[model samples]
Target: MVQKETFGEVIRKLREESGLPLRKVAAHLDIDPSTLGKIERNERTANKEMIEKFAEIFSTNSKTLLVSYLSDKVAYEIMDEDCTKDILKVAEEKIKYYKKVKKLIVMPTKTKIKPYKEIDSDVLTLAEEEAYQLRIGENPDDIDLDVIDKINVWDKSVKVEENGYYWKGEPYITKGKLPANDKPLVVELFCGCGGTSLGFELAGFEIAIGCDIHQPSINTFKTNHPNVSTVLGDVRKVNPKSFLQLLDGRQVDVLIGGVPCQGFSLNNRKRHENE
Candidate 1:
């Protein structure tokens, strides 16, 4: 059997077979040599633009290279666990069912639109399985019930206390100090509802503060993480001096942000509107 090569391995093999130096290829791709090396070694993930450049430089089919790149991403993410195969199998079935439903809705057929309560049990099972997979992926050992509970809370009105944070009615409270963390402080900008901040906190980083323009999002974030200060207002209009004041002379080890994706996202209401 021919051994299947990973995306990075294929890239490296193609480059070497073409007698192109790493530095030369990196320069052509307009990326740092170290970054290219990391990509070839599978230590780094390649973005769509980088993959496109690689495909162009190597004179390979872009779609084929893209598939390889995406496959590598899924492989690395799941780490090829036995459970992942089952999850993917169910996911594929769900996709097929969804497509069939969509076709029925769009094809002017006599098929009745199924209400939520009337949906197939198999669909519900698929959804539940997918959710379980996501939860397991995040908390492998099925630990951290607090985080899990908070994640399942769809209503903002419901109050739950866990891990040092308490949500009562509106504002939350920190029952104790931030777990005596010595890790570097992180400041998250455009932090909608604190999902990313929660991940960082779980990874042992102390989140000093977060900022966002949406009031409801800020409220949810504050309610979840009362220990971390939250600022509400347009990020562009917020003064840099204010951030320094929030830092209180402490060094900001890392700053993270997810810039608004509405303009670029296909699901956005104004996606087709010109900037």
Candidate 2:
């Protein structure tokens, strides 16, 4: 008998065939690697949004990929629905049935990597634990919104002064400031998804400008901080002089970036020939 590969097994096989590592794939989708691993192992089923992301990243047709692992009845039914929501509904139902039937077993190779739940007791309540397991590095979609609202309400009630998104009673956001009140007007550089800009605002700095290469990150920053000016392009291509021009002749508080570390690493042995 040919051993039936589970949905996760099919996904993992596809991921490997594409020559992409889990970490790279996760980063492309803004997901945690372990969470992706869990999906590949079928420890948890991915939601509609994540499933769509996987489809895009893996370059696989979502309906075709899904049908490969589903029964004929389910496969045909899903082919009819086609939309992500319907596909996810079918996947979830299949996952639920798989769980109840105990027909699915964690593959031995996958078991060696520990589950995410094993390491998170420090920050999660029982409910948050469930939520965390369902979606790593994001608010769990499976969780009831009302329950999450209650938790957020309770968390905010205790720390009313803190201004940021809270996750499981801890701040998912951080704010920072430069020492001394004499620091110059701030312009954020390579400001990823507005984290640094938001931090500057929280620290009482007037964010006059921000810049980033990624369009999505720039758009997100614009959405959150409409008052701040942002230029979207390669930091190197945008002359430092032009960046200062955005400041309208004001001094900069900070500039930050990892200058293509791979470039430095490639020259490491060449430059250190004496060693």
lDDT of 2 by residue, 116-219 (tens): 33444764456545544454433334547677445432222352332123112311122122244454466776665777767777887777666666566667
Instruction: Score each candidate by Cα lDDT.
Output: 0.70, 0.59
> TM-score: which candidate is best?
1
TM-score of each: 0.40, 0.31
Q: What TM-score quantifies how close candidate 1 is to the native fold?
A: 0.40
Stretches > 4 Å off in candidate 1: 47-56, 59-67, 70-215, 223-226, 231-275
lDDT by residue (1-275, candidate 1, tens digit) is 43378888889998998889999999988889999899899898877787788888888888888888877777778875769988778878999876755543322224433222223446545655454344333322445656855642233345533322212233221222334456899988888899999999899888988887666787898888887877776666666777776666678898999777755664544333232
Itemize residue pairs with steric clashes in candidate 1. Answer: none
